[model samples]
Target chain A: MNCRVCKKKAVTAIPRHNTAFCADCFDRYLMDQVRKTIKEFRMFEPDDRILLAVSGGKDSLALWDILTRLELDVLGYHLDLGISEYSRESTEKTRIFAEKRGYRLIVEEIESEAGATLPVIAESTKRPPCSACGLSKRHLFNRAARQYDRQVLATGHNLDDEASRLLGNILHWQDGYLEKQLPALPAEGGLIRKVKPLNRLTEKEMATYAYLNGIDYVIRECPMSADAKQIFYKKILNDIEKESPGTKQFFYFGFLDRSQKMFPYSPEASPPSEKCRMCHQPCYTDICSFCRLRMKLSPFPDPEQFNGTHPDVISLHTED
Target chain B: MPESKEQNPDETESVQENEPRRRAPTPIKVFNAQTGDHLEVPFQKRVSSLLLELGIDSETVLVIQKDSLLLPGDSIDPRFEVEIRPVISGGSGR
Candidate 1:
């Protein structure tokens, strides 16, 4: 097949777009797609530094490469979940990429700081592994943004992830989650502004981009995510996508375009936030979830003893 | 020499070997990166057919030959080494 843009020998085919592109053209097309997504969502300004939450996977690394190519001020924030060899390999990959490109990176190890690995914490707390992982990431990413004085926190969530999440939410009729499902979530009540610049791209496209551009990423999925419901949803969506090309995009973007307006997001619409007495972070309850988890693990006699004294929060950006 | 009604042993073996070579193709080695499964797939005209034979949806995984992404319609050589990497991933992203 011929390249859609330059008519060169095409190497990759984008079935959803009904087009093919050679290596060089694919790179340009990917960058253009990310650029359009960023601009379309008003994700951030030229000067606003982007703190990318990189998982060392293809999606995150690919986004980091694209954003750097677009010449945006971007910093990488990596959280080591300490899931045995998986965490070790992924952290090493992220470190190597950052050092090779002369990009600044912050690495935080959950086990080292929190005294337990993610799985251990999840097991001890009887919470789902992904839930624990996600909560910790959300708290830390927001904290990292504020600590580094960055305005925006960007995640490498692509079309598949968003679409799958939307499907799950819709299946459960989670109106609150549906309301918060936007590419760009405004910072509210001490939360950092969050954005997903890769929301328009698919995982396969990101993998291909990484492959062609020589961006090395961890190829393995999270070891603890074998039973994650999100994966099940993604599989169902992929099956549907196989039957109907562009169904995932249409369902997700269509929501973003039309249905999203039905559930407008307002800062005041959410539950009121109060400063956690333990960590001083904003949470709906008296103590934030992270602090609550830490309290559960450590069994502090008085919450006041640890007021404004979370070591992980202060030392998150340090090298291991 | 009663021109033996039987073929020479060497000639008979040569014909027997050439018959299978003409009928059967060298299977393509497909490595699944996700599962670390190596499979020998029979030759198919297009990449899509090979994936279908493997029961993999074209949208779910990538079929790569020598670092080049093969479209579903692209013809694949049975002698070429191909890798099937599943693109679906579950992570902490919500």
Candidate 2:
């Protein structure tokens, strides 16, 4: 088999795309898609300081690699949610990747910053592990971007994530979440502008790019992710995608194209995002979920609540 | 190894140094995400053929070697050891 572009021996085949590519061609192919997506959406200016929310995963790492290779002003921001060895290993991976590439990396440890581990909060807090972690990540990513004076925040959220999230939101009839699913969420109310460059790619492609490029990433799924309802939605989308190759893409991008006209998700229609009364971060409600969860956990006062008691590592780093 | 060569002297004579002999189908060690065990299969086998042999669906599992994902049409190569992760069905970036 030969690469469709360069006629070199092909390294892999993407049947859905009707093409095969050698390692070199595949790199070019991946970069082309990212560049095109950025241009189509006018994601960021060349001078924009882009802060990447890297979880030591293939998707985020691949985004960083492409953005850096494109010579854009990009920095890596990692949040360690204190999931024991997984969090430590992920933080180390992020550090190594950034240091090796001569890029600046900022690490925000949840234990040090918020004085609590994710496992501890999951036990004492109102929200589940995944929900708490998601809230923490969002708040910290935005805070880190602001602290570093970055203009944009980029995430590794890919097509499968977006499509599955959309499916899950629709299934639950979550209008607010559906509105927030847009590829680019402009900066407002203490939140930095956020973008999903990987939304143009999928998990498989990101993994291939990371592998071929010799990127060291954490591949194990989070222990807590086994119970996430989002995974069920992903499974459904994956099933549908098998019967129909392009269904996920059409469903996601088509929504991006037509969502506004069908459903008004403008700032006016939705409740205006306001600063969290406690933490001064953007939240729909008066008190942010993270702040409320923290207030609940404050009574326990024991950082080692879930340690050693649960032999099994209950975590949420699924599919990084 | 010596006993095999002695038993098949003619076979040894047939193989020339300049012309490399065709090797048997390459063996692939797969970590079955379902059974959580390592199973070996032929790398030359097509995706559909291997899934059929393993009694798994194409949608339920992903075949990856050194992180290079192989779709349904792509065949595995023996140069790399592959891992078959669970229902994390993977695909094109878009």
What is the per-residue lDDT of model 2 for residues A214-264, given as tens digits with 9 covering 90 to 100?
Answer: 888776666656677777777788778878787888999998998788677
List model 1 lDDT by residue over A29-110, tens digit each: 8888898998899998769998999999999898888888888899999999988998998999999999999999999987
Residues B20-48, candidate 1: write the lDDT tens digits. Answer: 55557777889998878888877788998
User: Candidate 2 — what's its lDDT?
Assistant: 0.74
In angstroms, the error of model 1 at A280 is 1.5
Clashing pairs in 1: none
Which ten residues in a row are the worst by lDDT in model 2 chain A? A307-316
Q: What's the TM-score of each model vs. the native?
A: 0.88, 0.80
lDDT (Cα, 0-100) at A319 in candidate 2: 23
Who wins the lDDT comparison?
Answer: 1
